[model samples]
Target chain A: MSYAALDLVMLGAAALIALVAVVFGRARVSWAAAGLALAVLLVATGVFDNLMIAVGLFHYAPHSVLGVAVGRAPLEDFAYPLATALMLPVVWEAVGRWQPADVRTVIASSRPISWVNTAYPFAAAYLLSTTNISVTFVVGTLFFLVPYNLLMYGINDVFDYESDLRNPRKGGVEGAVLPKRLHRPVILAATLSTLPGMLYLLAVGSWLSGLLLVLCVLGVLIYSTPPLRTKERPVADSITSSLHFVGPAIVGLALGDAAWTPQLLALLAAFFLWGYASHAFGAVQDVLADRAAGISSTATVWGARVTARIAIVAYALAGVAVLLSGWPGPLAAILVIPYLLVVAPHWNVTDERSPEANRGWKWFLWLNQLTGFGVTLLLIWWALGR
Target chain B: MPGVYLALLLITLGCMVILDWRYRLFFWRGPVRAAATLILGVVFLGVWDALGIGLGIFFRGDSPLLAGLTLAPEFPVEEVFFLVLLCYLTMNLYVAATRLLSRRGGVGGDGGNPS
Candidate 1:
């Protein structure tokens, strides 16, 4: 019933799923790539999670945790990255066995660089609200960290493979140009991979949390999948993408049984706006490629220059929204300036030159690291009473 | 002396501007674009501070280094200077880093030459 027990169950289930999918799915699993990915994820999760815990941003109840500490994180924490490392490549291999190519493409689609984007929000919200490491917290964090990303990006790679083929930005860290035959298996894998975590989460969470979780999954699904593909719907695309990142935090807060305080609402609003700006700005770079492939995105529909302007406005609004969170939250508004500065140079970038915005987009990636550090400091300050 | 923190921040901002001017570190090499970027950044951050003040998350710290002048309840005048400095510093660093990488011929579509 405790988090430690649930952690063990989920870990076993994830490993089992990965094993069965790889074995019976008739996929070629590269031990070297899988091993490297697992090592890297483990080290990253250990370092970042420990740093947050050390700063008193949150803490784990000793009994609920497995008492096996790697730095400050419990042994159960490794299960997330480990499960992801195991599951994704096998899924990729299973899905794309006809191609039988390098595992690098799968790694790229997994978006290791942005794993913390989903994981951090869930962990922070759940920990801040509950202040206890419960089954819900563990399940939510693990789910967001791995299965959530698998579903989000796997489906993206599958459906967007055609556009990605035309996009110079694909086949690397930004995205993966998955082969055509892998499409069905990838979708199946995404669904199957997420099922166990989803079931466990629903079992442990309330109706409110379940609803948020469903919305989160729906956002992931509709954003990339055809027929209901929201990513091609202009402004709605940005809104849905934002939901993909912010939904988990809402689910965390709800599952933690946190009150709907004005401060919490403001934080969520700010977070949502930030997500919108990030996706919009990201869309700017893909305007040319998306259009070439007959896709309709916020950037493609509105044109690159206008989308960039919208992004700036959204980022500014996000900063303002965060200010409503009060004292140190006001200090956090300064963090938005970096994003503004990065995007400002491309203020008038044309569709022909939108690809140039990739330079700023690259900085945006590193900027997230810096901004995350700044937010961590602000969180510590808030936790320590200004 | 109460404004020493603000003074240091201004000095740092000045240093970054001089460096940028001398090195053309950021793409907004022209004074007009740079000034525009800075102003926009300050305004957005200021609005954010105002909202935080309204929501009651930001309170002026009890540091003697603060100028002790209130822009609003729990809002200090020094924050403006601090934010300006933050915006300027980030711009300079981003441009400088990008320039350095591109100069080394390591820039790729994703920004860094991953290969």
Candidate 2:
């Protein structure tokens, strides 16, 4: 990574964390003091860095820098002090505010079970593409495994809590529920914890991958937040949810600089179709629940039967798309058969009888693990062949 | 010349200690909290430095004005001491400034009981 890029990421993350600490943690950072610190630190850096560099202590790779200089010190060298000035006080304040139960609550709200659903794609994509372990792979996978889910499901649960407060059927459903008191903490924790990993990934990635990462985060936000709660929109709901899973894979592929071939595109298209299909299928179980809650979804809008059929078509098309993936990719096509079978039994599922589809949704969950295992084998074969 | 860099850092750090003791500003005000914050800052900066080194954005200068001992490749022994001094200096400046600002009606106190 370029020194400037890394600096930018650190600078951006520090500034954002500082802002969030002020807004939510109510940390009162004295800007004037920070300024004084920065000014003094910068002068020290200018004097020492030049002296250090002039002594031949280290050198920079020719290809990895922008050639920008402040005397002998790279302009990028200043970010350490600048970032420190911005971030340390917030860390000081947060250290005082740390609580144990809040940690447990944040973890609970992240939906531990569903964490694998998002992490697998990113990890698999990066591992398969790069074929080597590096910091990006480890950090990105961990990010996807936890903080990413925390942001996705944590934010979702917070909104779910609000909706469930008015939900007469809340106690009827056994799932993670965000309590009212934990709202601000959840949002703060989710956003704050996501910063380091997200910023690092953004810095290391190409512009295209960075855009995809931003879209992935935006997908998480817009799906839950108001004015564009795509979660409540009819067809957009499944598309947004699909984006949630597929987005991470695309980001990983982009970061690993995977070649965008026809086979890869076809495979991704299949994955995309599978995602929306699974999402629409999952919506069937909640048709009655959502209708009761006055929430609009593909199932509530088109009734359970049409939604189920659309899912079957999406799965079948996903299989077709996978066939064009070449070599071992064709073997992965059979994996979608179980998905089709899961939704097939519910082909005639009606709005009044939608709750029964929850059984199939249960099958869908385990089927994912099985499918994941199958896909892993195929990916290994494909990677070895390459 | 062998320990010029390390000595400079220690002297600078001593100055910060004096400032803190004289003003009751950072470590003198709250030893535990100040120590924790300074440690956190050092760890944070250390990680950032490690990442930069891993990415090949940083290189160790083979300087003669330093101890030959190293903590890691390109990471000199002075680096840790430098980080400590940097963090301590920042805290002293922050606490002193916050005290001054609060006296002038700023929202944040100096993170201690009101004097």
Question: Could you say which candidate leads in TM-score?
Answer: 2
Summarize candidate 1's per-residue lDDT along A223-335 as a digit string, tens digits. Answer: 88889899999899999999988898898888889899898799889989988999999989888888889999989988999999999999999999999985788888999
Over all chains combined, what TM-score does candidate 2 have?
A: 0.73
Q: Which candidate number would show the highest lDDT if scored against the true structure?
A: 2
i-RMS for every candidate (Å) is 16.4, 3.7
Indicate the docking level reached by candidate 2: acceptable
What is the lDDT for B93 in model 1?
Answer: 48
lDDT of 2 by residue, B1-115 (tens): 6888889889988998998888887777656557656865675576577668778877777678878777766678888898898888777776766676667776654434523
Q: Estimate how well candidate 2 is docked, as a DockQ score.
A: 0.31
For model 2, which pairs clash?
A57-B61, A58-B61
lDDT of 1: 0.71
lDDT of each residue in B1-115, candidate 1, tens digit only: 4776668768877897787767774323534335534543454345444433433433465666666786655667767776676556545544454445456675411132321
- Tens-place lDDT per residue, model 2, A169-204, is 334323466677667667766776677677667767
Native-referenced TM-scores of chain A, all candidate models: 0.75, 0.83
In angstroms, give how far residue A256 of model 2 lies from its true place: 2.1
Show model 2 residue runs off by greater than 4 Å: A1-9, A28-82, A92-98, A166-175, B1-57, B61-115
